[model samples]
Target: MGFCEVVEGRHSIRAFQERDVEDASLEAILRAARRAPSAGNLQAYRVAVARASSVRRLLAQAALDQGFVAQAPVVLVFLADAAASAVKYGRRGETLYATQDATIACAYAQLAAANAGLGSCWIGAFHEDKVRAALGVEEPLRPVALLPLGYPAEVPRMTPRRSLAEMVLDIREDA
Candidate 1:
């Protein structure tokens, strides 16, 4: 599918099939995430792939009882490694770079999953402290998004979106 088609087809899928996602497909998705642009090339993100039942249970708990997280074949926890970036780029990294890096990477991963014929949902509602504890992240590394992936159980209809003219702003001196 073309880029526009992929974008149009993508949706926040909450229901998934029972089949497991292939490792090759997961690798491709991760590779796409790695290719995402980062601030000063300091890819300040870490993805924790949770598949084990126990881990998924903990993640579901951390995600405010979102059972779909545990039900999905793969739950990718995208984390911002502020301390890692700070170590290389100094204190400015935390405030300016790490969050953007992680968010962009997560978006790329979502697109990659769509291209691979998998379904995904970008989950941002969760307790930070609970997520940190559940994922065992060390200090200064924070969870940014939770992505649950698998074959979609139900085909999703397109959601309405604002027109380009409404969302974009053009301020030309000549105009």
Candidate 2:
């Protein structure tokens, strides 16, 4: 599918079918994420893929009882590897660039899933500490986003968006 189509076709899917997502599909998503740009080529990010029922259950609870997180066949938890960023860029890398890199990767993964005819929801409403504990992650790796991926059971109606004029500002200094 075309890039515009991929972007336009995607919706925040909260309901998923009982079918399992193919491994190849997940691999494609990972590939897209891996290509995301990062500060200083550090690629300071890690993804925790949860496929087991017990683990997904814990993730769902950590995601503030967003049950769809557990219902989906897989949940990918994006983590910011702060120490990796800090090694080169120092405090700013740890405090900002690492998180920015992880979020970009998550966005790429979400788009890749949509392009593959898969459904995904960007889940950010969760307790950070709970997420770390659920995923058994230690320090320097912070969970930044949760992505629940699966086949959509319900395709929601398109929501409205702001016009370019309303959303953007032309700062051309010719004024």
Over 1-175, each residue of candidate 1 has an lDDT whose tens digit, in order, gives 9998888889988888999999999999999999999988989989999888788778888888999888899999999999767877787788768988999999999999999999999999888888888778876888999999999998786789999999988787775
Worst 10 residues of 2 by lDDT: 151-160
Q: How accurate is candidate 1 locally (lDDT)?
A: 0.90
Candidate 1 versus the native: TM-score?
0.94
Give TM-scores for every candidate, taking all chains together and pairing residue i with residue i: 0.94, 0.97
Clashing pairs in 1: none
Candidate 2 residue lDDT tens string, 52-130: 9898999999989999999999999999999999999999999999999999999999999999999999999999998
Clashes of 2: 0
Q: After superposing candidate 2 on the true structure, give the runs of residues whose Cα lies further than 4 Å from its correct spot.
A: none
Q: Which candidate is the best by TM-score?
A: 2
Candidate 1: list runs displaced more than 4 Å.
none
> For candidate 2, what is the TM-score?
0.97
